[model samples]
Target: MTPASPTPPDASRRSRGSIRKTACCLHRGYPVDQLARQCDFLEVAYIMLNGDAPDEASYQTFRETITRHTLVHEQIARMCSGFRRDSHPMALMCALVGALAAFYHDVLDVENPQHRALAATRLLSKMPTIAAMSYKYTIEQPAAYPRNDLSYAGNFLQMLFAIPAEKYVLNPVIEQAMNQILVLHADHGQCASTTTVRAAGSSGANLFACVAAGLASLWGPMHGGANESSMRMLEEIESVDQVPAFLRQAKRDPQAFRRLGFGNSRYRHRDPRADILRETSHRVLAEVGMSDRLLQVAMALEDVALTDPYFVDNGLSPSVDFYTAVILKAMNLPSSMFAVVTAVGRTVGWVAHWNEMHQAPLTIYRPRQIYVGEGYRDYVSRRGERSAELR
Candidate 1:
């Protein structure tokens, strides 16, 4: 008998697994690290959406457009007030954004460029306000309204830190650091949250609902909450001296150890964002005149992990989450607020990807999976007969 022909390669599997070209490059095709060093969040957002850096006239218009939409409807604020004070900020944000569809159905037209633009601007502007409102609601503080006179980052800082009967000055260092964080996180190609956004948008869903889906996906610990987990891990370590023991424990049972921010799935080398954030974290911490033991432990842990043979061999390195926890902590933001901050920055990326998907010729996203299970068999209604068949 002739030998059986070799099995044909699974083209579907290969195609599904293959890496595609990335289209989220910053202005002039600069890398994110370089872009983070040069541009603020608004400029970066403009570049991501428009495929070019904005000129002076366009930049002013873009900034003004976003500023105009910073205030949400009074009903949305009342809706946020209904959530329990202890509710997770991200959960509140997801609900609020989803509810945006109910209030702004006129701008849900994906086929209309003007409607899409307005929707994007509204989301980008109001997300920070919504995030800050969530925080104030959780702490039972009266919501501090947005100040359009301030820069975007400055306005967010005011909303978060300003309170009645006190003038809160925006520190230049903190404002710059916050802007850098937002710009660096503005877009990463097909990240979990972005993929979620795209998948939802594939159904021709309203922009607000699609973005709300992305926010929900980002609430997972493995994604946007990495910084919060990383902060918690650092706090647990408590001191630099304990980092060695922590590392040893991690080596033994990684699953139980929960190394939150040391590695990234897509970045094999040091994450470009981490480098910029490290510098910014140090600068901000020093400027604030803060000396945090947890920050020290985090730094030492990163140092040891980078030098350890096991981590080096396994391609594990500091990711953006590593230093971001420290930076946010230095800014006096609670660990609970970390993911909300991430969502605030990532909203632009979600909007950009949603627009891209809507404008493309792509159909609805329906991924196939390989089934490795028992073949079809007769259904036995009786439990006794089913058990006997199994035996």
Candidate 2:
């Protein structure tokens, strides 16, 4: 796939409007690289949901308010317990998030500005808890509660990794890297998911409904599941030496041995988030000092993909998903959890877009389609098949 050239923004509105511009792979007006380097996810999320950056007092208040809502209702856990233990985390995440609407009725009044803010805060805060708990449900491990003392990413790591009986310390390096990942993915203009949220919100569906609709759209492998597929691809390669053979197969039979995690419909030359995560992935692998062969394979694969003529000719530069798989693997996260983690990062974007849609003159989204079927065919009924006219 050829990468897309940056589309100049509609200057009069100052909005990128879609993923093609994505504010130029930037958020608001702040460059994503700057936000990834300088700001925490919560602060960046604050800036996104609100028009202005928060002052010291406002930021503290915002962070504290969000932290207060991280814990979900007890029944949410009981509901999760009923699912088969083999359930994928992404499926669990989507189901649990949709279930939130039943629990959070007070925040349903989207017309009320206060209610909108509260709804966004609740989703943003509780998403980590929900995502972590979903993973625990799959593993049949006891779910961990949110910790107030930890930063946003630190709390997530603790909830996923910490056992009450065992003292688990939070590592700053890991937490910072995780926060960057979250911030980098917080928004990317519009998508099938974000558009779903917009359409739902236009009809005054509450935050959970809007976000749930969005998440369901994101569940496909071509969308939020790319990182998971990328991880699976690396695992298939197994050893560094096998990467060349895999590439050869990919080049020969592109459809049968598909390539992923490279190229984008957004950036023309490189994915900005990929640039950020490439460096972060290295830092994480070195800091964790893991002998994980998959990371080694990823390193080799990345090198080949960057240099290979086939990839370069197709403008198949590594996208964020490429290194995201590497980073998550280094953190010992399973491939199954990759999309779940993506949902965690994307909740902010979903909420932000939903909020924006409500703020504007709302219009319900109806997809435009071109008919491609055999047109003007006479209705015919055969054996068991009923004609449309009968209905």
Candidate 3:
């Protein structure tokens, strides 16, 4: 008998996993880990914006351009004042970014490459300033102006933690940790917020508006707020002795336990970003002399979870959000500001996605939805006769 002919591959199923499979950054074809280790956030942003690492002259020019834009428009400061003192930073950030379109209408043209570039630069440079302002506004502290003399991360630290009399000294170890956090979060291809940016940009909206939409999406607990939730969970555990009980509860009713940041959607074994952050968290905690009982609890919990067959079978590994919570807490950031920091780091990614979508052959994004409801029904007007029938 003749051998059976080979069956052709299914075209419909071929692209099912393509989105996750192709998610990556190819800055000069370097792996993301290499980029995160070798470059600062400014250098990473340069690569994202210009598609390559900059030479000396180009690096100076780019750095200067970013530094010049670091100071937000004064009108933006006034707009931030409108928010209530108790407002969430993420909510304030979402509103402020949307308001940027009104303040910067002069550069709102997506079709003009120069306008797009300008918007990207302004958003990338000023996000930290905006985020810090939101934090200051909540505490009724005067906003600190951006100091161009500091590095990007240093400037943000100064703005965030500075006060009236004392001069804020930037610690080298904390600055390095902050840079690593920013670079690690700078981009993750087509994540929820990035997709939101692309979808809004597809409608030819202004760049700031597109990013505002992305910010709104990022505010969801499942996306950018995971670290905040993780930090809260660790606090609830309270100590290493309590970790086993929490794990038992988690295993009993997963919904009740609500494991906030254990596993990632993309990485089954380990998130590469988590590896860098885990080490950084230890180093920063050691250098900063911050006592974090939660970090100890988290480590114990991770040990318990990893050894369990249930967690192992389900691919439950610590993700970027897990270690990030510890690091940010060690840095003295409140849990509420955790997501805002993520938003600040991710602004460059959102702008880059918006720019890329506009530069391509543009098409409005409209996804098809399955109709699961009743197909058709007779129109019934709420008139006298219908009212009598209902009665």
Candidate 4:
């Protein structure tokens, strides 16, 4: 994996097939490696996934574009208004995403090129709104509408907590950290969720339908649920003192907690993004004055696991999930909200990929497989007795 050499847009467009993988990150292009070196991950995602690198103006425009879509729909907000304040944020998030599918039914019903572009724009814009609204609803707060004038990061912060008394003053460090996280997590080529998006899109399902398919894939514990599970592991340790032993036990029997985070992919020995996120988590924890003993334990566990041979043998590295919990918790967000935040940032990449697919004229994907079962069988009527040999 290396930084992408400068190539003409047409050349790059044609280069896609040389890179696409059905299930792994692009089997050919190293978008993550290229992104990790130069541009912020968000911008790289827009380019690599969307197929065009946005200039400064375009970047600002899309930033504003996403912000403009962050407002909660009046009807959806009303529906959620009646739910218990203590209900999990993910529950509200799920409903909000589904409601959005209904709210944009007009676009869903239209299939023309212009209509597809419009729907793409609408979905890209509105995802953050739905995610932010879910958080506000969980807290039973009056949802703050999107302020068009704010930068994407600023606007998202405002939507999450809008009142002046407890206003979110954007910090450069935290904003950069969040942007990095978005960048790193944006598009792992043909990840389970991305594949879901492509599969549904291939069927000519509407944009929302495709997004919902991706969301369902993300809901699986083996995928997006890893972040939530990682945090839970931290909670289980409870203190720095508990970390070494936990790692030893985990090392002692890797399969015992194979279900946990830090050891699934066959890529890097450690997820490359973890180092940056671990630093960001430390900075955030220090800045926010959050010193959960659990966080300390998480850090210690990270150290032992990184050095341990068993983890190294398994290609187990601290993934994005390992640090997301700490970062979100430090930001005062509950565990349930992390996945939605992940979705909000990711929708940009999803639309970009969808748009790219539309341009290339892809047919509905249908792969063939070998059938190993008996090739011929006789049909038996209810009134007829089957021969013992046939049975």
lDDT winner: 2
List TM-scores for all candidates, in order.
Answer: 0.89, 0.90, 0.89, 0.81
- Rank the candidate models, highest TM-score first: 2, 3, 1, 4
> Can you write out model 2's per-residue Cα lDDT over 52-164, one digit (the tens) per residue?
67899999999999999999999999999778999988788888898988998888888899988888888999999999998888887899999899889889999988886
Question: Per-residue lDDT of 287-335 in model 4, one digit per residue for the tens?
Answer: 8775677677777777777777777677666766878777887777777
TM-score, structure 3 vs. true? 0.89
Candidate 3 RMSD to the correct structure: 5.7
Instruction: Determine the backbone clash count of candidate 2.
Output: 0
Name the candidate, 2 or 3, with the larger TM-score value.
2
lDDT of each: 0.81, 0.82, 0.80, 0.67
Residue-level lDDT of model 1, residues 1-391, one tens digit each, is 3454498623211111112133123333656776788877888888778777889999999999999899999899999767888999998999999999899888988878899988998999999999999999998898999998998888998999999989989999999899888877776666788888878887788899999999999999888998899988888886788889888888887543435887665655566677788889889978976567877787798788779998766656667887888889989899999999989988887787777765655477766556798998766755657744776
Clashes of 3: 0
lDDT of 3 at 364: 80
**Model 1 alpha-carbon drift over 4 Å, by segment:** 1-28, 253-259, 382-391
Off by over 4 Å in 2: 1-24, 253-259, 374-391
**For model 1, what is the alpha-carbon lDDT of residue 1?**
36
Candidate closer to the true structure by lDDT (higher is better), 1 or 3: 1
**Model 4: runs farther than 4 Å from truth?**
1-45, 48-50, 82-87, 109-111, 164-166, 255-259, 366-391
Candidate 3 lDDT over 1-391, as tens digits, reads 3444497522311111112223343443556677777887888888777677789899999999999998888998998778889999998999888988888888998889989989888888889999999999998899999999998989999999999888999999899888888888877776888888877887889989998999899888888988888988988886788877788778777543434888676754666777778788779878976456876787787677668887766666667888888888888889889899898888887776676666556778765566688976555575635534665
